[model samples]
Target: MAQRVFITAGAGGIGKVIAETYAAQGAQVYVCDQDHRALESLRDGITGSCVDVTDEAALDDWLQAGLAVLGGCDVLINNAGIAGQADPVEALDLAQWKKCLAVNLDAQMITCRAIAPVMKRQKSGAIINLSSTSGLFGAPFRAPYAAAKWAVIGFTKTIATELGPYGIRCNAICPGAVSGDRMDRVLAAEAQARGVTPQDVFEDYASGSSLRRFAEPEEIAQLCVYLSSDAAKFVSGQAIAVDGNTETYHSV
Candidate 1:
């Protein structure tokens, strides 16, 4: 039987690549994102939907509907998240923090809460969360994102511990600066905040990593796909960093 995989924030970037990777591996893949048009543009092999994970009802309904169609989810990639406005905590908007937590942390919890029972019944499953290098270290001007990602790491471990006996494995993928539009946006934001050119921001982050280059979205997606597969059946409760040695740099 083809493995049934469900992924959040799968319209583009790492999420989209993850969906494609699994689908190519003969899994039935369903992907959801808030951008309807972008979701539609994804290849036909994926089951795509426009979903705002922050809306509990909508997320639940979408998941239920997807489960019904896909027969039961064997794997879930919780990739929906937001990098809110960059600002110091003292000047940060509370709403921005709340929103960041809503999508990054709370939404993943909700999805896990809703799906764990199904996996428990099946007695086998894997959950791959999209955390960040920031989760393992402090990131200036991104307190909320960092906090929520840290929460995701903790959440993955909790689930892994609780569900380990049930054969449900949970793990997080902490990616370093992924190269793409998201990187461009982050670079632009950093440039604005630090009064440097985007090129300088990119150079600084690249230099921080031992590889001296940003990771491709496909590279991150490949790790996620592997974690969700039977190959990683023994792996659980771990936060694996695909960071190219940036862990050495504690700075944001």
Candidate 2:
């Protein structure tokens, strides 16, 4: 049977690849994104919806429609997130901080809360929450993003325990410096803040990883695929880092 998958931010980046990968594996993938263009760009195999995950009403509406079309859901990839305001703790914008938490942390919880009963009824499901290396290690100037990710780990663990009895598995994937447009933007911001070149910032980030390179989006997607499959049936309540064994994110 093809699995039903609900993925947040499936229009681009890591989320896009994960949706595509799952669809390729014969899963019924439903993706939602705020970017209409990106949503439209998604391949025909996956269902796409325009939505902002931070909004509970919008998310609920999207979920209702997608699950209706999908029949039921077997997996959820809480892949939506933002880089947030890049600034020191003292200089951080309160509004941006709140918005970051609202989208990255609170939204994931809301998503699980809405879908718990559905998965529980099914008697089997998996939840893969996207976290970050920053969650494991403190990220300088990206406290809000880090904080929200850290909370996700705790959130995933708690849900794994709560939903375990119902046969629902919950886990987190932590990626470090994923390559693409988002990383470019982050490096640009870090460069501008430190009065250095983007390349310098990139090198600093890569140096922390044992592989000394940013992970390809597909790399993260593969992990999601495995976690959602029976291949990882016993994996739950764990935070797995897809990073290249990143030692730190504080260099430079």
Candidate 3:
């Protein structure tokens, strides 16, 4: 049987690549994202709905509807996230912090909550949560994003232990400075906050990694496919980094 895979925020960026990669491997891919146009533009093998991950009710609805169509989910990837406000901790806004946590952290919990029962009954499934290198190290200007990502690692491990008896595996993927429009926007924001050119900020980020370059979206997507495959059935509760061996975090 073809694998049934569900992904959040799969309409664009890294999520899009992940969805497409699964589809290419003949998996039944269903995704949800906030961008209606991106959802509409998805290729034939991939299907998606417009959903704001922060909206719990809407997210639940999307999951239920997807479950109905896919029959059952073999893999669930929590890929929705935002690069929250780029500012000092003292200058941060409470609303922005909440928003970041809502999408990056809360939504993952919501989806996992909804899917756990299904997986438990099947006695086999994979859950991949997208974390970040920031989760492993201190991200100077991105407190909310970093905090939420750190929490994802903890959440992934807890669930792995809780679900292991039932044959469910959970893991977190930590990608650093992925090369994409999203990273472009993040660089622009950090640059503006630091009063430097975007190029300067980009260089700093690249330099932070031992590889001295940003990761390709396909690189991250490939890992998602691997983790969800039978090959990685024993790999649970691991916070794997795809950041080209990050040496240091860029400073403000």
Task: Provide TM-scores for the models.
Answer: 0.94, 0.94, 0.95
| TM-score for predicted model 3 compared with the true structure | 0.95
lDDT of 2 by residue, 1-252 (tens): 999999999989889999999988888899999999998888878989889888899999998898788878899999999878778999988899999999899889888988899999998999999998878988778889889999999999999999999999999999887888978887998799999999998888888888998899999999998998889999999999978987766521
Model 2 weakest lDDT span, ten residues long: 243-252
Which residue pairs in candidate 2 collide?
A: none
Each model's number of backbone clashes?
0, 0, 0
List, residue by residue over 39-86, the lDDT tens digit for candidate 1.
878876788888899999999998999889987989999999888767
Error of 3 at 79 (Å): 0.5
Instruction: Tell me the tens digit of each residue's lDDT in model 3 across 118-161.
Output: 99999999999999988999888889989999999999999999
